[model samples]
Target: MRGSFLYIFGGIMDYRKTVIDKLKEVDSIKDIDIESILEIPKDSSMGDFSFPCFRLASVFRKSPDAIANEIAAVIKTDLNIKKIEVVKGYLNFFINKSKMMEETFEKIFSLKERYGFSYIGEKKNVIVEFSSPNIAKPFHIGHLCSTVIGNSLANIYEALGYHVIKVNHLGDWGTQFGKLMVAYENWGDDEKLKEEPIKELLRIYVKFHDEAEENPSLEEQARYRFKLLEDGCEKETQLWEYFRTMSLKEFEKIYRRLNISFDSYAGEQFYSDKMPEVISLLEEKGLLVDSQNAKVVNLDDYDMPPCLIVKSDGASIYATRDIAAAIYRVRNYHFDKNLYIVGTPQALHFKQFFKVLELMGYPWSSDCRHIGFGLVKFKDKKLATRKGDVINLEEVLDESVARTLDIMKQSASEVDDYTKTSEIVGIGAIIFTFLKKTRERDLIFSWEDTLNFEGETGPYVQYSYSRAKSILRKANFNENTPYDCDYLKEEVEIDLLSKLSKFGEMILEAAKRDEPSVIARYAVNISQTFNSFYNANRVIVEDKNVMNARLNLVYAFSIVIKNALALLGIEVVEIM
Candidate 1:
């Protein structure tokens, strides 16, 4: 395994390879001397490694089939390649199966939970801003997309060995807060506030909206209150602080259940003091221009709409605070990348924001990314908390749990402790349902689909695992018994093993794409394959050798299921 052969094999074996090695392999071709040609086949039956020989036909003065056969012959003689075949002018190489299986399993079992993780992002810092709910507003189904998407992105990056800083970016410094303060002052009730903080706050907010529709002065009053808050009015600041703190206490309960934590709660208010510096930097860069009595950044050159840095009333805008936040994150954390997990509606906002930073002559601004996702729409209508057309996230979680409990009661008659099982099934269902689809797609929230415990659903996967556990328990599998991989030669067994080999690649791909749905999809696939294998072939047979081998496979499946579930922020119980 020296020279071009070794380099090609090395590049194929490990995804992280230098370009020089790949080039060397390409240059070493005897007759053709091609630059590069490689592709992962569309299906497993097409072979693991494929290279198109059509390009080489011109150089070699022969037909593509001739070139493909020549390449196939060379690959067949190579010791690293177990087999080589030519199909439709393409050369396919299948590495030795046993060697690949052993090496993959060794890496997986040795690394355990950290098997798929890598240090490609070592020495890199990434700031992920997400879950930024407005203070005193109800945390509704709409907010769930951002919170989970952002949190999962942070987890994915951290797992890839990046220094991740999670920020809430709370909407604590907006005109809405002013309206809330004024409404509270006008129609404030102490006992009602204590009894139902969010409901009462929302009531006052709705009242302000309704009143502002009739009494135009109330709109101006709200703006004046916001200006005072911006000017560091003592009372306004006090009220903002109280509202933020109280709101966070409620938000924390949901965050705790979701297993999401932030490194900092640096919202708009936190970046207010840095706005002047941002404005000065913009002026120095000659990017700031006065437009309609407001400080604006003209981004026409970048084909983006103008960004308002300051309103006509001399109050800072969200874009200004975001710019300051970006600068502060780079200077303080020395982040290699800053990821903003906002909604797609704010796509233009980020475009202008990043464009402004680029105009300011920051090189790292080019690396800052905005991971935008589609909205979570319900069947009735799109979520609108302002109009009270919203479903509370807390209620969703509660309902998920209750539904799981109902299912558990219908099944599992021998269960003595149903409460614990219900909790696991319920929470698992919610998390899995959320992650089962592509992040870019808008999920139509359906109770029926979420509770459907069949066909690629979360409950189905959990039940498969439970079934495996039940079989293993009944067989009384002895850990001390010796197991051999040779018994794993059946088509079903090989299918499961092949999937197990792909776990590391799956995680790496998921992290790269910033989508946990990849892992969810893989988990479902593995569970289905394993269940099929278990059904077609007896895992706990009377024969000791077969039983031991099957038990080993089952144990391996359990490890993978648990690891994949953990990455998605789900817990897998031993029994369930």
Candidate 2:
């Protein structure tokens, strides 16, 4: 390929692209997409990159082995490939280790913190709507998935040069507020409500539901109060405003501890005024129909139930507000993509919502995506807010910090600030656990898995980074001096360099799949790889050339690992 593209970083070539470009010289396979069939060999003994010739057997009208032999003999070899081996039907290409090491190390040192960033998402705008916790309720563990996942996705997009808009999309409107109003009026204590707003509000919220079983008229009264709120009754509006303000003040404490922020706190209430405009647009397009005296969009043709926009009693539902909010975002931000990081239970709701937008002749509706994740379970039991069975997020954060501190004390590890460092590692542990797996799978929260420093957890990666820092400090490494790649000819060094070389490619792949776990898992693999290299050879050897090369390798690894964890919304501590 001649290394034609000088991507964001300097002199770092894509080896896979090099192999594919070389293969394109063959006339028979020139028309084929060689990139799709290229694979990284499982065993390093085979080769660095492999190209199977089985798919070309039909065109050549010969056996797979014969095709492989013919292609290997005639393929171009002017690139950084040391040798090519034809094993059975596979064409394995061994990379030139010295060139690979030099290129990777040079790129890392040149770019530093900007390593692995690209311009793939240049000039695009993305809106990430997540952590839409209900006001007047506890911020429990159930909200963790959307909050962290959405935040990490934002970070990933920004690394690729995308303009990201983070929206909290607070759940601040509905009949639930009516129930809260009734409960507060009858049983609320003003002093307690002021002391712990979320707790007192949650208590009253649960009581309203419990009392409605014996007295059914309470349900009717709740609905009437909601209608009054919708009608802008002076008393109800004042109460709603007071509760919303208190809830935001309480939610800020948890967000600050987690180091998460939002560009917009515009909740469902923000769209209340925009809903009528959406309804009018639907009517103009002949997409809204009357069903059971309620406004709905018929979707039987799409094999889904009708999407209800308004209740029979003339009240707007969630779908109404969501459609309005989406339209508002497109007009204001002109977003290229809008993503919803809600739970899997709301899958059907989004499907119906998107279909309605499509029917209304909006081409941008296709860019609106729903990123749903599985529920959070404790002891295999799902949490419910109305039942008062939930784990507060603040409690989890505080307890994790305390547990981390206890472990540090038992191990006799000394740090300047025990509490502050422990809090960083502790919260990082929880966030990493939530992101280390695919979002579709349910996550079970446990003390052992979260706090395990020896496992494939966040603390392990953080510890590895700390160890690298310690080594560099002991040796007093000088980055200004040039290092020789010739001395780094060990097998372990090659493997670590190969892994480090793929960071930029791995980042783009993660963005393509819309999965943050890709980066999380990469952090674990790279940490383990660096540890293996350290255990096999010493960085502080007698020879100046060998010591300098290994030190540079260690420095490159530290930089890459820190960048990977940052993409997952994780922070690394210098001491552990």
**lDDT winner among the candidates?**
2
Q: Write the per-residue lDDT of candidate 2 for residues 161-275, one digit (tens) a residue.
A: 8999999999999999889889889988889889999989988888888899988899888888988998899999999998898988988987887899999999999998888
Q: Model 2, 209: alpha-carbon shift in Å?
A: 1.1
Clashing pairs in 1: none
Error of 2 at 292 (Å): 1.4
TM-score of 2: 0.96
Number of clashing residue pairs, candidate 1: 0
Model 1 C-alpha lDDT versus the unseen true structure: 0.76
By TM-score, who's the top model here?
Answer: 2
